[model samples]
Target: MTIAAIIVNYGTGKLILDHLIQIREELATVPGSHLYIVDNLSPNGDAALLTEGTTGMDDVTVIGAPRNGGFSYGNNRGFDQAIADGGYDHYYLLNPDAYPRPGCLKALLAFMAEHPKAGLVGSRLEGLDGHIQSSAFRFMSLESEFASAAKLGIFNRLFASKRVARPPQDEAHKTDWVCGASMLLTAEALEKVGLMDEKYFLYFEEVDFQRAIIKAGFEIWYVPSAHAIHLVGQSTDMKDGKQSAGTAPDYWYDSRRYYFEKNHGAAFADKADRAWAWGKRAGGLKSLLKGQGLSSVDRDIAGLEAARKRAAS
Candidate 1:
């Protein structure tokens, strides 16, 4: 089966180039493959460099979007193009900052081939140092949302939460959702589930897409044999430097509320939203009581409340 690899890029030229080089070497063993890079109007001129560098590869195609479409819309444009172009049985959605191991794609594709019911399969993700990262998760319900808001879900166990929670870890195990960093989806699955919801902008888009895929009767699988190293937060850190105020929190919180409201009900969304707001208020109050000063927690709480109100309405 033909496979098309799609990378949605927004700056980080060096990382993207490195990822493509590694992918090219890996693709040599897996023939009838194509690579497409979609650049979302990065200000650093990385798009031009990517377009020029990847032009030499016969299977590579590059498209530059007019503006930043976030992950969903930007990746969707290339995905739709690849699907229309035909000859591809699967589409690999990869982040610019993620680099697949030598046999990662082959392993994932083999798993997909064996499991026809799995529309989406994600690899075990590790950091640069090879430490495990949480790439698969259960669907977020009110209880799960509350636990996370309270930082009591798995933060206590930290990296071992996946093991402690006993999240499916096998050659092929079903999951509610997998991280979008390096997910492979069958073309048929794409046709059935439609494209990623652009309204998500950044966070929670994968969760929303996986929800739709499951609703459409497709299973999401986590393949432990395949692996990829993801430089998580690359885009977010680039957008708002490491030390800057948390400018991207609103997008995340809003998207979370949107997903909860759309899938569950307003009550679930309301409870999660209130919990998040209360968490922020308590944090801010604790800071004041300790003479540490508020760190914009009040403003964050107000924003989350506004988002909750909008979602409820």
Candidate 2:
């Protein structure tokens, strides 16, 4: 019944510290729980500032990482520490920008205990306004990847069932992966999967880890009843719901290339780049006839091409 709730923090120190305060009530409802924060060597020294929130909480512990190893590395530090501490039956990974609604953590712990096969479960994420953010998903395939980047309605129709991204379902359902923002992992499953891969600087780390979890013979579920509010892009410097070139950063492209090349192979990564490039062109042509720029076609073809080439090198 004991669980470790881990948060990975970068420059978002006080933000996550405030998050710790918000979850205090939920933690009390559980049989046993502890909070672990991994400070990823924030250049601004926000790591030192975060200690104010731990004031009188004996269950809270902080790990000061020697370097910034990105999202996966930071979370893995807490994961390893929790397992070493022993007696913890579950691990909950929450984004610094996320806080569970009342009874949210309880719902995840109760569900995992009820279903021994659900190795990992994710909370249903809603924004501050209570609108469901897309978190649960089908596993990515060439079809889904191409369909998502294509910006063509036909591709979506062709690959509707295989689509990789999906919103949280109204009912609980088994899924390929859930957003890392709020995931609960069982101790047995963590023992098998080890820890989150550090190779990912930021993106796709959860997808890769969840894929490995499934391969290790465990199910992942999206639990709608476990509600959490996530203000997207708090730590990553992305906002306004626009993640275009302006928001795209170097680590993101690097992570994207690494995920595809490491998991699917270099050749497959190149194929994905070409697929999106072709899809972008097709959409551009459609826009030309309408006398307008292609709309919402946000694929960064040049950046992806560069990443694909870097992976091949």
Q: Candidate 2: where are CA atoms >4 Å away?
A: 239-247, 286-299
Candidate lDDT (C-alpha), each: 0.77, 0.82
Angstrom error of the Cα, residue 156, model 1: value is 5.9
Q: lDDT tens digits, residues 102-150, model 2? A: 9898899878878889999999999988899988998667777676666
Pick the TM-score winner. 2
In lDDT terms, which candidate is top? 2
The pairs that clash in candidate 1 are none
What are the clash counts of all predictions, listed in order? 0, 0
Q: Which 10 successive residues of model 1 have the least lDDT summed?
A: 159-168
